[model samples]
Target: MAFIGASRGAAQGRSASALAARLGFRIGLVGLFSGTLLLAALLLFSLQPMFTKRVLPILGGTPAVWSVAMVVFQALLLAGYAYAHALTRWLQPRAALATHVLVLLAGVVFLPVGMAKGFGAPPAEGEALWLIGLFLASIGLPFFALSASAPLLQAWFARSGDARSADPYFLYRASNIGSFAALLAYPLLIEPLLGLDAQARLWSLGYAAMTCAVVACGLRLRNAAPVAAPVEAELTVEASPRRRLAWIGLSAVPSALLVAATAHISTDVAAIPLIWVVPLALYLVSFILAFRPAQPGPDRTGRLLSGLQIAGTGCAFAVVVFKQTPFLLDLGLTLGLLFVNALMAHRAVYALRPPAARLTEFYLCTSFGGMCGGIFAALVAPHLFSGVYEYPLLLAAALLCRPGVTAGGLPAVLREARRSAVPLIGAFLAALLALVARGPQLGIEVLMVCLVLTLAADWRSPARASLVGIAIGVACLALQAAVMAEGGNHRSFFGVHRVYTSPDGQFRLLVHGTTIHGAMRLRDDEGRASTGRPVPATYFAPGGPLSDVFEISRRVNGAIPAVSVVGLGAGSLACHARVGEAWTFYEIDPVVIRLAQDANTFHFLSECAPDARVVQGDARLTLSGRTEQARVLVVDAFSSDAIPIHLLTREALAIDFAHLDAQGLLAFHISNRDFSLSHVLARLAAERDLTLLQRLDPPRQPSVGFAHSPSEVVLMSRDPAVVREAKAMGWRAVTPDLSRRPWSDDYANALEAMRDRWRELLTSAR
Candidate 1:
């Protein structure tokens, strides 16, 4: 009896040991997959800003460059998802693993990623296509390989025999969290700490580590049952076409809005990576919230959607009232609208998510939708619409994505249209009356009434709400367009350029985004053309700091022989050109040149600089082959108030200095609302052992002849005497802040550079 009892105890101990070992293995598998996904997403997101920063100098540092880059990424993501779907559908587990590993190894050849050489200079036209080709050739393989990892790994986990393998959508949350972390860390941590080369090296190491983790994940699941040989009972419904279309529609709205919002906010604020990341970070956060294991109930989702819709409509109203809102408030409103609207749409997407068997297919459809949205925003919209009409259109589309909106199909849609027709038609007539009467204030009041009525009418019916919301949006945009109808709108790869007469009707102003680029005094107080040669107005007023740079240069050098200007803003600087002096202007945007050359718009270029040469293309690319040395070089290039950091970097300065005579003066127009660029210029001068002087001229009250706006100019020279003489006039010798690093082609931190200005703003607000 004692021997039998002992045998029973040993058997029970063995069984317990086996159970513990199995539990440990399962936990290890989960960790490996999760960690691999996290690392892969980090590398994927961080690569965007890193690689784009490197290319900004190649092209001019325009925000449009970032838009095109997003399109490439979305396209690559779709391709990666399709590849994953194919592998899972046709290949066995071991074969699929081998294939993916080989693809990753192929990607390794492009490690330590940077732009590919031999692409040469980009074209004057078709820049979008050229840029797309460049990205594909340079970073395509590595990015493609990395993009496949998320879906492939999730699919792998589905077949891994783990307890939660039957529902692998939870892993998606981990992927986006990594994405969010990477985006936040980039501007805040990585950009401030590491140069581009260092970032590339560290990223390559992370990629290699992630690859090993992916391989380990494959090994962990090698002996498990094949995907086709499913054992446990689970959801197996084949995704119908209608369901696939629903997924696509739900995904497209946020993706398009992501691009549109980025463009809108960045155009007004600075077009730095930090601004670009905010919208994208919110977008990823929406995905994280949407794909969570638990979601809100139907009633809760409906309330959330309604709240967001109302808030978004209110924001639209604010945009109409203040054509150019305060930068910070505008940014907050834009991002808030994006987050709420995206969350609502993505929640609907998660509701229609397919089961584990169709995971890759589901991802493929979603990615394809994203690619479509990006394509529309980046490639098509600029050519199709004269203004940023896509933004409002997408906003309206987002409202339509609310739940139960299309429950009654075509018949339901007809009923909603009938119900909404009276209000919509009434709003249209009211808008027409406002336009015909030419009453701006009355137009605004009518818009307010229409919006309120629309929101209050059938607020519960998504169809009625969506239709009226679109009408309201269209009316608002149309009203704004009419208000600016006196101006001619021109769209280019760069941005919108509007030429309009000022409210006082004394100056013809050229505006980009919210900032006035140049203003020409067209008529005196008597409403007649001025007699003498047209003088540069606005920032280029006769007594301004920019004029002082030329005066001091002429004083030191005896006579200014040649002059080169980087930005051709109304060609105002051309009037400053003296006879017998060779003057050249380098302009990137063809549209700006056209407008400046049109004598009807502003005659600074045609009337004053007709004899001057104008070079087309980015100054960085166009100035490299210049033969003549200039005694004075002015760098006044700007896309709105945002200065191109590439043009201010050490490498860029070297190029400018190379084209300048030894005694030549280099003047940078540093007038900006958000940044104190004197700090940047001071550091650059110190690093290069050059002398620097800055002058900040305060604004004068508007006069009838020429309005003198505030201007700031920083002058740099190899000759100390030149800058010293300028200092005697009105310029102050600036000291470099040793605590801050100088910007270079390899490194820059626009956010950190703006820290002082931000502090000043906060103090003033307080």
Candidate 2:
């Protein structure tokens, strides 16, 4: 009896030991899969800004570059998700794991990623395609492999035989958390701490680590039964065509809005990746909130938030249209609208999510929608519309996706209330017409207020409320278009340009964003439209620093001077060219070139220097290849208030020097409302042992023949006579701040360089 009892105890102990071992293995598997996914997401997101920064100099520092890069990423994401979906559906667990691991291993060959060599000098035309090809050749393989990670790993986790594996969608939230963390780390921590080379090496090490984790995950899954195998009970549902389309529609709105918001804000501000990441990071946050497990809340809470979203978006549109707020406030409102709208759209998608068996399919559809939205916003809109019509159109689409709006809600409402609602509708239309007559300010205000009241009164009826909201919003947009319509308004890859005549019709201004690029006098002092020689206006007005540079150049050269102007802003500086002088213009945007050369539009180039040569390409690339020597080289290329940092770097200065004669002066138009570049140019001049002269021209009273705008020009030369002549004309010798490092091609901190000016701007705004 005693021997039998002892044997029984030993067998029971052995059974307990086996159970513990299995639990440990399950925990290990979860860690391996989750860790791998987190790392993969981190690398994937961080690589975007890193590689784009690497190639920004090759392209001009246009915000369109980032937009195109997003389109590429979205397309690759769809391909990766589609690939994962195919692999899992066709093959067993072991086969899928093996194939994915092999692909990852193969992708390692593209490690330590940077821009590819031999793609020198972006072509003047087809730049978008060239940029896309450059990205594909450089980091395509690794990025594609990494893009497969979120959906692929979540699918693998579902098949891992753990109880929690039944719903793998939670893993998606974790993935976005990783992505959000990475984007935040980039500009805040990584970029500030490490150089690009170090960043590349570190990313390579992380990639290797992720590969090993992936292998470990694969090995764990190798012996387990596939989730879709006959023995395992898996929940599967048929994804109907309508359901797939719904998924695509819901996902596309936020993606397009993301690009639109980025473009809008970046055009007004700077075009750096740091600014680009803010909207994207918020976009990821919305995904996190939408996809996470439902929290305890009242049923009406979501409806209330939805109503608020619509009202808030309408108000934001009004504020933007009327220019009633500061830039920062406008930016905040735009981002807020994006966040709330995205949350609503993404939540709708989460509500319709299929079971784990259809996980890959759901993600694939989502990626496809993202790709479509990106293509529309980044590719199609630039070709289709002369303004940012995509922004307003997507906002309307988002209103349609709001909850409580049934498919036939508006039609049903109209049919049910034909008798009672007809007068109401007619009254609303009359009010809209009255507001339109009053002008854009009153129109937007009345429309926004009407939308808020309409939404508030019928919050429960989503369809009725959404219809009213969308109509009001669209009407407001139409009114805004009319109000903001200045003749010759055009949009390009760079930014939007508008030509506006001043109130007295004496000045015709070339405007980009809020900055006036050039102003030409339409009528003379005698109030006649004098067709004499075109006078230099705005920053190039007579007695401005730019004019001083020309005077000094001609005097020092003792002959006809060869002048090269980097930016062609209505060709205002062309009037500064003398009869015996040679002038060439290097302009990046073809639209600007066309507008400047048009005889009817300002005609400075045509009237003053009709035979001048205009080169169309990035100045950094085009100027470097020029063999002709310039007695004066003017760097005046600025898109709105955004100064391309690449054009101001030490290497760019070196190129400028190489293209200048022995006594040539390099003048930089550093006039900016948001940043101070005096210190930057001073540092560069000191490093190269060149004399630097800076002048801040005071604002002059407006005259009928010319408008005098504030201007700041910095001149650098190896000759002392150039500095002396500049000082005689109110230009001061600026000393370099030794504490601040000179900006170089390999390193530049635009925010740091502009820190002081930013503080002043904010303080004044308040």
Model 1 collision count: 0
Cα lDDT of candidate 2 equals 0.81
Please, what is the whole-model Cα lDDT of each candidate in the order they appear?
0.83, 0.81
Model 1 C-alpha lDDT per residue in residues 1-766, reported as the tens digit of each score: 8888899888988989999988888788888888889999999999998898888776778888899999999999999999999998898778999999999989998889988878878888888899999999899999999999899999889988788888899889889999999999999999989999999999999989988888888888986645544622433567888888878888888899899889887776666789889999999998998787554455676576676776676576657555757777877778888888888778888878877888999999999989998899988999987677777777777777776663444466667799788877887788668856977657766765876677766677777887777776676667666666767778899998888887767788888987787888877877887656787888888888988888898888877889999999788888887778888999999999888888888888777767888898888888888877998899998898777889988888988988998788889998887887888888889888887888888766554334777888899876867866887897888888867888998888787668877886799799
lDDT of residue 545 for candidate 1: 90
Return the top candidate by TM-score. Answer: 1
Once model 1 is optimally superposed onto the true structure by TM-score, how far is the C-alpha of residue 400 displaced, in angstroms? 0.8
Instruction: Give the runs in model 2 whose Cα sits over 4 Å from its true position.
Output: 1-20, 223-236, 300-304, 406-460, 480-486, 524-527, 555-560, 698-706, 759-766
User: TM-score of every model?
Assistant: 0.96, 0.92
Candidate 2 structure quality by residue, lDDT tens digits, 540-574: 88888889888887777676568899999899999
